[model samples]
Target: MTAPRTPILAGNWKMNHGPSQAARFFADFLPLVQPADDRSVVFFPPAVSFAAAREAVQGRPDVRLGVQNVHWEEGGAFTGELSVAMAADAGAELVLVGHSERRHVFGETVDETVRKVGAVLRGGLVPVLCVGETIEERRADRAEAVVVEQLRPVLASISAEQLPTLVIAYEPVWAIGTGVTATPADAAAMHAAVRRTLAEVYGAQAAEGVPVLYGGSVKPDNAAELMSQPGVDGVLVGGASLDPAGFAAIVAAAG
Candidate 1:
């Protein structure tokens, strides 16, 4: 039988949290999540804070660090973009590709994500690929189609062996940072669809090994119910993650 998927509780700090703030966050955050191992806790800090984050969690290897974004090329003059090697050198074990803000706000294209995913893998970091639909698409009842379309190219290109190392997060645009969240049922539906797509590319057995997370406004108050949903592996917390107490509570709820 296949091993059960270990829940991944990732905090995407986005454009928030500087070096000092990141150090302070781990001071209060680490105590609550560590000394146990039922789930994985990851921090996607901005590049500038990687040193502080890495040092803060020095003794805790269980706490994974990821870069918020990366450039597909190993090095060059991309202006403000980060390279996967640079992220890895900073203690990043994962990379976030195609987050909503990266796509909507920064114009991250599907082609970029496809190349980034390949680069992340080649650089020995797991890719937490984000795929979701916007308010307009969901309102038009095309949410699943939009998400599938966004993810298909990358999924089709990756080898079956690389599939299990990847994670998927569905953060609907309407629900992100607007104090809105997809209902547990709605989240589960989309997660199931993601798995179906994965299965199509790599067979049902291989797909089952991929962890699909529900993001958006995932607060502690609703975390348990969201985690209870079938196929809902864990969460990609946003604003709530910046708060030590609240984010700790959400991590506990995931357990």
Candidate 2:
């Protein structure tokens, strides 16, 4: 049988690259992503680059385009916000929601994130819903509780059958760009916790099929061990994604 979950290596190009840069970056990077392999590789540039990314990977079957964020409403009067339809129209197969940055920087409430997840799924786009605990939360030994809380709100908005169309990313707030990567064992334990929570809410099928990714300062060196974990399916890359070679190396490690 194929692996339990398709390994997904996604890049979150946060606020970087306009269309021109996006096209150039993809041109440089797409060749390394082999769709024939047993993995799904996706990338999200700033909203401005969705068009460019779609064009860049048009004929290449391996590269999938995603949007960094989206509005819950399909469209209408939400200036400065992109709707789920807008992202799909721009050629995105996935729409990232509830990332750490969105929560900490944009003042996005859990309720808002839940609505966005619903919008992404209803619009025929996969939702990459992110959940994580802050440094303080981790220090206080509340990481599991924090993640559980985040998952509850998002799960509340999605239908049981739609679970497969969603990806859950667990990114520790303190590990993001802090050069503090969690040990593989620690990350694995969290992934298991996520799986348990999923099973509790949506049943064993959802728990078994739903892919959970670990995102927090992942590099080529640690990627292999991370993937070897029973519960860690893939990763959500950040700064490393900006460098084509660095990202490719990590993908190779995943294999």
Best by lDDT: 1
Q: What are the per-residue Cα lDDT tens digits for candidate 1 across 135-222? A: 9999999999999999899998799878878999999999999998999999999999999999888899999999999999999999
Give lDDT tens digits, candidate 2, residues 1-255: 234788898899998888898878878887876655588888988987777788888877777888888989867897899988878877889988999999999999999999898888889999999999999999999999999999987887677888889899999999999889988888999999999989898987667889999999988787888889878999999988888878988888777
Error of 2 at 136 (Å): 0.3
Model 2 clashes, total count: 0
What's the TM for model 2?
0.96
RMSD of 2: 1.4
Best model number under TM-score:
1
Q: Rate the local accuracy (lDDT) of all candidates.
A: 0.92, 0.87
